[model samples]
Target: MVAVRTARTLGLALALCFFSGAFAGVGTAQEKKAEKAKSKLKISVPQDDAELQIEGKATKPTGTVREFETPDLEVNKAYEYTFSVTWRPNNYTTLTRTKSVEFKGGTADINVDLTKADPKAPDKAVIRWVPTPDDVVEEMLKLGSVKEGDVVYEPGPGDARMLIAAVKKGAKKGVGIEIDAKKAAEATENVKKAKLDEKIKIIEGDALKQGDYSEATVVLLYMGNEFNALLRPILEKQLKPGTRIVSHRFTMGDWAPDKTVPVKGADGDEYMLHLWTVKEKK
Candidate 1:
């Protein structure tokens, strides 16, 4: 009986001793580990009552981490954090932003709103009209020596011609005068050969040179392009009321003529003839 019981009892006693020593060492290690872990997570909050949260891949374990574990440590392995704070306004603006921020490491969006409207929006801008100078017109009106019954004749090309035509039309019944183009004179001569040259006087002089023609109702013009613009200011200043101006070929600078007549040429194409009048001061 003694021989059969000896081996079995001895083996059982040795196994029990090994297990007890292992358990004692494990308990001592657990106490030391807990103390270290408490010091590492020094998560103290400020005076402001803000929410604190944790986020990210480490915090929210997924994929292969589902079954992962440390043989010694019994702590949660995930890590994440979040906080709540007041957002500051920019510059002197009344705009303010408020947000609850997450600890995720990526782009975040913040929205802002204004407490009041922008002060600069109410400012008014100055606007001005850019027309012919008043002095220029005044100078023109001062030259109103020509009476309503005085003769006016068209001269030169371009705007000068237009003014001449306009003045002729606006002149008194027997006052306005017009000189047709050279081509018009030929046409007139073909129709009626007798006294055609006398009726349409082709004066070969630069009308720009100031002179006296009291008998004329208005001066008609069909002069060259360059001369027309050059002579405009002079004509406006010196032209008398009864003495009108008409131009056919070119236009004066920024001048709105009183009338426009469309003439059909030999080719059947239409050309616009402008007429401008010097009105009496209102």
Candidate 2:
């Protein structure tokens, strides 16, 4: 009886071990299945960079992974937005995507997917300040009549960046500037030597509003054709008959000028320099 009881006990122990092993194996399989279901798409960007904005239906699903990369990453400035995306279950790997856009300044949107796919190129967008519609008309008129020795109308000194670029590209450029005592002290040595710091008077008020073109042989208009249209009547009456007006990257609107010259800007923007000499009096 003792030997029979021992054999039975051993059999029960063996049965328990087999069942436990089977259940343990099944539990691991289920856990892996759950993990596969939880896998998701990942989006990444660089730290300390500008915010990545999402619009439209993309904004939903707040739990989606967000990534960052900075403009500094692309030293070449070839791409405005760049990021890597991937997925779990080996469905995807780090994929690089990019889009091209105009130079208009603002937060631009870029969309992506979990499949690690390439997106179409971004539409041509402007990153710079686009003059208003009315300004567009005005700019065309102003740019059409541009000639050498014209004071390019710019509101802020920062606007000089464009003119400086044009000058670097061989456009004869000059500006009437007025510097304050503080600025004069810190002026570049060349500027001081040229007396630009003292003689080029910086207008105390809005330079565009001051209506002071007395010393201007020409007014280089960059405001766009719409604004030029509004200025058509003003130029018709105020400007000297032989005075030259030049415009950049705009078309002449309703105002018919004396002459037009086609030219390319530093960035290759096509512009027509229109010449209007007091619309020769009838």
Candidate 3:
């Protein structure tokens, strides 16, 4: 009986040891996973009160800089960090800027200075309000085959000439997005004057940040090369297959147009119009 009791106690001890070893192994794996899931980000701003958003979530700033840990990220996989900063330097003016960066699972730092103007940044003033002549606008619409059942979108539509003409040409709806507040208001007024207010809508906002253009069957552009390039990715990503993009006087970088045509403007000068159709994804 004594020998049997000793054997049973030994067996219990071995079983407890085995279970404890298994639990320890699991704990080590969990620790390693937690380490891989976190990344560090530090951002410096020009002002303490400047509002900042990291990955679309507002992050509080401490003094001129803020450091925080990001949420779970895949190990060694790069992720795009999209952030925006907004601040006011004076009572009359407010400024907002958005930028993006890519980061893997590691530490990253960025500096955003709103006090100094970015020389490379595309300016609305630089684009110049060159309205497509009435006849040229007609040709552009015709090139895109704008007609009934089509929804047309024009970005930076200075006075909304393109949208106005498109609606008059038989488009189901026309949408204009202008970055300049004054331009947007003027466009709205023009739409009302044309008595197409019900068919056209003018939005006052940055085209890049507006984020939705899937409803548009046709797009009209009269912006410069820089502006067109800036908008290229958004158009490619958001526009649906077979959507037609028509541009006057400029082209997106290296993206060959499906067709190009020259038309004489009412001003007596010849202008070029380019058209592209979004192809189905492979």
Q: Which candidate is the best by lDDT?
A: 3
Candidate 1 weakest ten by summed lDDT: 122-131
**Per-residue alpha-carbon lDDT of model 2 for 168-204, expressed as tens digits?**
3333444433223332232334334554443233342
- Rank all candidate structures by their TM-score, best first, as comma-separated numbers: 3, 2, 1
State how far residue 22 of model 3 sits from its true place (Å): 59
The better candidate by TM-score, 1 or 3, is 3
Alpha-carbon error at 184 in model 3, in Å? 0.8
TM-score of each: 0.31, 0.34, 0.58
Among residues 3 or more apart in sequence or in different chains, the pairs in candidate 3 whose N, CA or C atoms overlap within 3 Å are none
Error in Å for residue 214 of model 2: 3.5
Stretch of 10 with least lDDT, candidate 2: 15-24
**Per-residue CA lDDT of candidate 1, range 1-282, in tens?**
112211122121211111122101132454346521110111222212222222111212222111111112222222122211211122211111122221211212112111222233211111111112223222222232334454444442211222222233343322212122453344344323432232333343334443334455554444333445555665666665534454444467676666655555555555445566665534
C-alpha lDDT values of all predictions: 0.32, 0.35, 0.71
Q: What is the lDDT of residue 71 in candidate 1?
A: 18
Report the C-alpha lDDT of model 3 over 1-282, residue by residue, as the tens digit: 111111122121211111112101122344356544444556666578877765455654456666655544445555565556766544423456566655554444434443443544432222446777888888999999998889999888899889988888899899998878889999999999999999999998877677379998999998777677767878998899999999997899999999999988778899999999999988
lDDT of 1: 0.32
